[model samples]
Target: MIGFKLLHEKNHSSATHKGTGAWFGSKPINVDIGQNPVFLLRAPDGSVGAAISSNDSANAYKQALITLVKNTLDRFSRGGFSAASLEAAMLGGAENARWKWDRMLEIVRNDFTNIKKFDEGGLYYRIIHFDPKSGLAAVSRKKANPDDWNPASAKLSIESGTKGFSEGHAGGVVANATRFFREKTTFTALREVVIPAHLAETPDAPFLFWSAACSAGAEAYSYAMYIHRLLTRAKATCPFKVFATDINQKLVEGAKTGVYKANKNDIGEYRAYFRRYGELDGDTVRFGKEIRQFISFNTFDLKQRPRKKGFRMVVCANVFQYYDDAARSHFLENFMSAVTRPGYIFVGPMRDPIIHALGLKKLTKYKMFMVE
Candidate 1:
């Protein structure tokens, strides 16, 4: 590993890279970030994997970084050449005016030694070194086998047993809007598919919706906004509850506050989203009383079964890809069992294949699923 000294200055800009060739214990890969660094490690034999990010709020970046690595390796087998080489190639003749690459790497190295715990999808990262300040985080197998990180010889969760909320930060409201929950499309789907499906089965019961692993309540709030719109448009008086749960208590609290400190871009074109469901009060955006009242935030673990079930629709997005096949099945089973018969599960685009593999049917019209 390269070594350096830390500079006191801070660079507000974000830098990201994707490629291959950086190896951490025989795993070939490429990914580098400045400002907010993310490191994902997988055992050579492929029995274990670890994902570390600078902040709990960098959820999208961490997920994207890991997904890119997995997809790259899966496609080319070797991924794309060495990450170091890729960095040089990208710079070409460019100058590092604002960002200090050496300073970033140095901070990452020094701060990584401080991490003591890790959490993902409610599982442990074995707790290695995680410096939230320097954005340098690393997690290794708690018990390493002489050869592969074979699960037979080692369990991944034997560290300090401290839970981490790093996985809770997905993105802001606009980020959620343009990417996952498009207001127009999502509303159409809810009205045309999810609502009617639930109505048919439980005509007299109040509709129930769950946002599993909901980070910072953005997705849940967005859903509330649209669910409000859908009901208003349809002239339906059915009562509904948007249950938003996350393993990260901090994020759940933030979600419960119904405040999002989104960026200028996040609050710009998507003004209506904030205006209708939430309000921009100075730097922080607060969800209106109407939408906030409908959501109940809980620091719930996904690994455990819910005390209650029978949700009309459940949304668990951007989380499935992190788990191994068996773990994925476990979570899928839990989710499917939680919903009403003929219920729907809304997952991200990356998780579509896993849903199919688990033998669940997809609502092709909206990229959601119907658990059979």
Candidate 2:
């Protein structure tokens, strides 16, 4: 009897070449982001094959060339070319197709790395890197603007066990607020909304605060702190009410638990205010009696119809970017329908156009606008 290891078995594979001498074999390619570009090849039976990507621009060009080779494989599979004849045709054609050959080679040599596996919509997808300077190729992948505030980044940090209400998080919020304020000013042809002067004056004035997408409770807690400070200073007779909602059940439970790390450095000058108004229980920070009394956190989807009526101010920031244009329009309509007349609506920077289209009167100073 002959003993054979399963790993030693070879699987049947096919190869094809484009018209520019680049060739591809039947294999799964994986792409991901890293300090350098990376590509991984898997055999037809999903065994490891080869990997590539390096610092040199030539590596990027080679990656691009491989992509073209893959395209040729797809074309050949579609009956456009015979796999057996592909290599000869491509090598011969490369002489006359110098531009295609050079372009393919340049792309493969310059802009590729970080190969990883991704599963999306029941299909596997690979992440690939391209040089943004390479024009349309680079633009194909969404790249973050280094200077722009990304709420998504902040959320990721919070989810990764970082303190959510820290100065870093607050700074992200402030940056988002500033950007939204600027965009609102330009879109509405009005002045920017400043942090409400009233916030400093009267925090306990029955505040009807609405946090539309209060994911994981960071935003709600931040607002609670803001209100707590205001009310403490005012020695106000009346209390405020915060209506915080999110689509995520897990985050809603977390918010209700009110547990968070006490990071004084992250909260900044608000540390004093938090100490005065927040109660610490283990790693969780609960809003002080005064602030807690006013906040009602719930699980609600912004895309759905509003359940409550008569909100004075609605903060829907960071929700719009998650939605498509049509969904955004529908959401805005629902939002306007839910709030009381003369109520304020605050959105993130990117939703200015959608906000304006809803026919709301833009307010100055706080990145807030009136929908009355």
lDDT scores in order? 0.50, 0.43
lDDT of 2 by residue, 180-297 (tens): 1122232232112212423443434455667777766666666666655555665655566678887666667867766666554545534555566676554446666665676778
lDDT top scorer: 1
Model 2, global lDDT: 0.43
Global Cα RMSD, each model: 14.3, 17.2
Worst 10 residues of 1 by lDDT: 89-98
lDDT of 1 by residue, 1-372 (tens): 211122222311121222222223232222222112334433223332333333212134334434444553343335433322211101100011011212223333332343222222222112233222233333232222212221111221212111222422122112122222532445567879888776676657888889888867777887887787777776677888899997778778877887777777767756787877767776577877888888899988777878769788888875543333455556777888898878887654434355667788877778677875
TM-score of 1: 0.54
Structural similarity to truth (TM-score) of each candidate: 0.54, 0.46
Off by over 4 Å in 1: 1-188, 349-358
Report the error of model 1 at residue 194, Å: 0.9
Worst 10 residues of 2 by lDDT: 88-97
